[model samples]
Target: MSNYTPTKFATALLLSVLLAACGGNDAPAPETPAAEAAGTAVEPTTAEPALDAVEGEPALADAPGGDPAPADPGAPAAAMPADAAGLVAGRDYEEIPGGKPLEPLNGKIEVVEVFNYVCPACAAFQPLVNSWKARLPADVRFTYVPAAFGPRWDPYVRAYYAAEAMGIAERTHDAVFNALHIERTLKGERGEDSPAEIGAFYAKHGVDAKQFASTMASFAVDSKYNRAKQFIVRSQANSTPTMIVNGKYRIKGTSFENMLENTSAMIARVRAQGSAAE
Candidate 1:
């Protein structure tokens, strides 16, 4: 909700992200790590784009009344499974973003995006993110792991989590991405993206000042960040916007076009046998 978007990995978290992985199926219930694990540790989804529309920009929009939105022009994102009921049957695997040990992805198509605010790649992927998001069916669950690849990425995460806490994400989520990615402003001269400064940005977006402050400093937000850390470690990814389908499959941007198609196909294939055990 804050004007600044947080990076996937913070500088201090790099070593922690590369730490030990929880090996056993500690929690269990079917497909995704959460359902199969004796319980579930489902993470957050791709952020809602902050909604600042120009006269002519392709958008990531949801069905206002229940209509499927337009598909991205670049390429098909992760596709639905061949058999709608077979989504859970895809091959099971876990990936670590940047291949640095992060957390353990149990099953399911675990799509974790490791983003840094300053990264051009993340920005380039922003416009198309909405289109890709709309197509996901029930069989798949997605998560966003804010990464502070370095000092530059830290503030963005702080702002991201803060907005989540304040419940202003719906209003300011896409705005922050657009501001940083599309606009390409934000020189970050004097740590202007700091929590306090970012809070101001959220206020400008229409979030109340008191709520924004509370959300930024809340224990819940910190806990959310902690969970994200676990996801980062399990995926072993080293960059932003990386997709780990079913933990076992790794998909990058070049492959992303096909990645979505294959993932959807895989999900449908798996889900057909039986429903995901929740």
Candidate 2:
């Protein structure tokens, strides 16, 4: 057994190769079509569907933690409620009078985006809305308020905050979308690139590994979500991509640009009325 001829060595190598090939063949095929389809992550749609807020338009089929915001795609919001003062038609959404109430920015115009990472619609709105965000007047301070709606939403939201906590938002925010929508990677799906998977993605992009893990579980991140929740509950946002101009009006639109336009108008409208801070 210790001494072998060149031909014997060659024979042994061939046998080993054959055994490896057999092992490869023995592995089972992937999950079946139906099973895979159900498990497969949904690729984000290229174009957004026409959103009708009042006509009972179906809510997003998926919610992160709770029910989708109540939007009736059929019946438009009731004409801003008769008693609503200082609000405008198709302009300001909420109705709390007084020249643009103060915001978390310490009296600056507060524009908050209540968004979820898993929502295709929110992903679609980002590029267009981001442009307006970039152009927001100096007096304005915009904030991103990621929602924690359900189990599905947490991973994405956590990934976002985790990256931010690790100070890698600039690097990972867009990459996350590209990962999920463009590359068709199911980083969101459990077991693959789950939260830990996303965290790894961040680490690859230069995020501090320890920082990423701690940020994911940090109370500070939880506080951020809590603040977002309270903002919606108090403002009665009731919809994704909602904007509150100076806390007096809610602005929403079919597309991000339109929402931005309406938001700008609401801001000016409130500003013209005059600032009312205590």
Q: Could you say which candidate leads in TM-score?
A: 2
Candidate 2: worst 10 consecutive residues by lDDT?
A: 28-37
- List, residue by residue over 1-278, the lDDT tens digit for candidate 2: 12433344334433432343344433211111221112123221222222222232223322367767888889865754322234456543546433233244465667777666554445445665656777877777777766555455666666677666767786566556545533445433222345555666667688766667668778987766555555545555544445676655667544455556667777776556566231
C-alpha lDDT of all candidate models, in order: 0.47, 0.52
Name the candidate that leads on lDDT.
Answer: 2
lDDT of 1 by residue, 4-93 (tens): 333322221222212212223232101112121111222212222233232332222455787688888998677645234223223222
Q: Assess the local accuracy of residue 103 in candidate 2 as a C-alpha lDDT between 0 and 100.
A: 47
Candidate 2 error regions (>4 Å): 1-87, 90-92, 96-103, 189-193, 276-278
**Looking at candidate 1, what is the lDDT of residue 138?**
53
